[model samples]
Target: MSWLVDKDWWMKTYRGLIVKSMKLSFEMDQQATDLLSKMLDGRGNVIEFDEMKNLFKEYNESIVFGCGPSLLPDLDFLLESGNLRNKLLISADGATSVLINHDIIPHIVVTDLDGLIADIAWASLKGSVIVIHAHGDNIERIERFVPMFKGRLIGSTQVEPRPHVYNFGGFTDGDRGVFLSRTLGILRITLAGFDLNGEPYSCPGKLVPFNKRIKKKKLEVAKTLLKELVSKGVGFFNVRGEPYVL
Candidate 1:
């Protein structure tokens, strides 16, 4: 248990392998394998596959975000900007409040319960779809969330043997949210606060130096995937005060 926290080499090697595996899976389109690796976190967990795909099918477009309080600066502008209309939003576990505080509600909220459990229940009760990423550890959160919410649960494929999470290289679930959004036929995707290589000082919070390395690597992955998506006719934009097509 102490090694999981205090050992730098352990994390670097394991997470590095996960990153390398993701590159391979993306090349091969073995998303199930990629997702399984992501879910494992080098600890342990088994992913349920059938349920995972079903969860992916429930949305048309997804706006994934970190909602790290810094996004509040652009929340209102984004909501009024009209680009996100009809898009399904998958707010990352703790970031849901960015939408709620600004009066912009999401279609669904996905989380592992690091924070803001009460807000998740509120969002769900208000008709927001909730997708809880279940693992061997968070059984309690999963059980609690399932009975309370009206939405589906997308079991992460990363929980299986050799687990991986394929987020199209956006770094975290927000980037994965965007990846999933594009894959589901959303022609245009605009990111808010998906500062891939940017220091997480404000809106999305700060990622430490080690995690930052992984993030940079993920951004490279996202660029390639987004390029492929564009070749397939998907468009991407970065939204601040206005949405800029990238």
Candidate 2:
């Protein structure tokens, strides 16, 4: 199938899924939905879709960095290659600190605010628009960190997108970055620090311990989601040193 055709079909399917999920959320967790709605009620400066579209208008390629153990190593190579300047840099939550520490500010940071709240805040302050996700599991996190962000802020939700919150169709921060890029019609996407088969590491900027089982599960989901995008004719490339299929 042609990419144009695939894009149309995938988007239609995606919207249908979002509608179904929203209906289910309302049915199964009305209270949680209500709580999230309230939390986002007074929030101003929410990013709009056209704003994001304009931000990426000039770019045809993007590189999304994940916080997997291999992120630093993979980033080192990309930095040396000097090709990063031509592509938008997107960091997935925990990877935000790594990029900042290396003196590279990501154009966008996607987070559930579970990783490195302070660093994510710093990045936001540095002009990196933060795409903050709000779900039932992270309501407290949202309440704690959303107010602390000092710069551009965008809200995302796993449920139905609301007045301020939008859904681009991804579960984890890394995949969300990819989803956002694809949604914006980026022609090519390169991934770094995404090692689904590598060793798990602790979430950056946090004292919480790492759970290999959970990390593995999330990686599986991320991989599946990315693969689905690829199957729908989106271009995805892995720049990790070691061979990574899919």
Candidate 3:
């Protein structure tokens, strides 16, 4: 009886973990679906790229830039240096305009619209691909803008309501923009100004806060996923503190 009791407890605990993981994964999937639906309501489904063959095309030499405050100082230099204009640019959420203002158009923009509403008008105007990560909070926005976007919109889902956007219980989406770059099969990636620390950088009256704990973890998760891809000879780069391999 004692052994059976212990066995049952262990089984329950293991089952609980499995259940949690499944729940999170489902939630993430749903979030991605909702965001994609909004961004692509009229645009239609995103074309599935051939990850195997296409992965080698232009991405082998591509450089991906994540938007962060640290990037502000060197934004001009980076953009003007012309290191990655031909290479695919993956703009993280809220950084879309920053890149745009500098005339450094990202091939794709990633965000859940937390701080991107203001830029939506111009971004949509430029006709760049936007990947919107969906969450319950933004359903109304999705419903409203999906019809308006009328261009390339990719959606991402998430497992948990982002910590910043929870009240009692609900999910909040952030820029899983890096994922957009990956989906495009860009094996070579560069992450700049992606500092995880929460410091403040200013532009006009606005301040770009550090609060990248969430982003950091998300980026780490992305790195792990890319590792498997890299081992198979996929080219990869992490341009954070120093250029490193995935």
State the weakest 10-residue window (summed lDDT) of model 3: 163-172
Cα lDDT for residue 5, candidate 2? 23
Model 2 TM-score is 0.83
Report the Cα lDDT for candidate 3. Answer: 0.47
Q: Would you estimate the TM-scores of all the predictions?
A: 0.57, 0.83, 0.60
lDDT scores for all predictions?
0.49, 0.74, 0.47
By TM-score, is 2 or 3 better? Answer: 2
lDDT (Cα, tens digit) per residue for candidate 2, span 91-172: 9999999999999999999987788888988998898988887766566776677789878777776555565567677767
Model 3 residue runs over 4 Å out of place are: 1-59, 159-175, 197-242
Count of clashing pairs, candidate 2: 0
Kindly give the number of clashing pairs for every candidate.
Answer: 18, 0, 8
- Order candidates by lDDT, high to low: 2, 1, 3
lDDT of 2 at 13: 49
The candidate scoring highest on lDDT is: 2
Q: Give per-residue CA lDDT, model 3, range 1-246, as digits (tens).
A: 012112343235323543343234445444645454434534453422232225336554445444556667556556556565566666665667677777766666665565555565467667666656565445666665555654455444443222111111111221144433444455555655454344433222222243445445444444444444456454544443244544
Question: In candidate 1, which residue ranges exceed 4 Å CA deviation?
Answer: 1-62, 68-70, 80-84, 134-151, 159-171, 201-233, 240-246
What's the CA error at residue 74 for candidate 1, in Å? 2.2
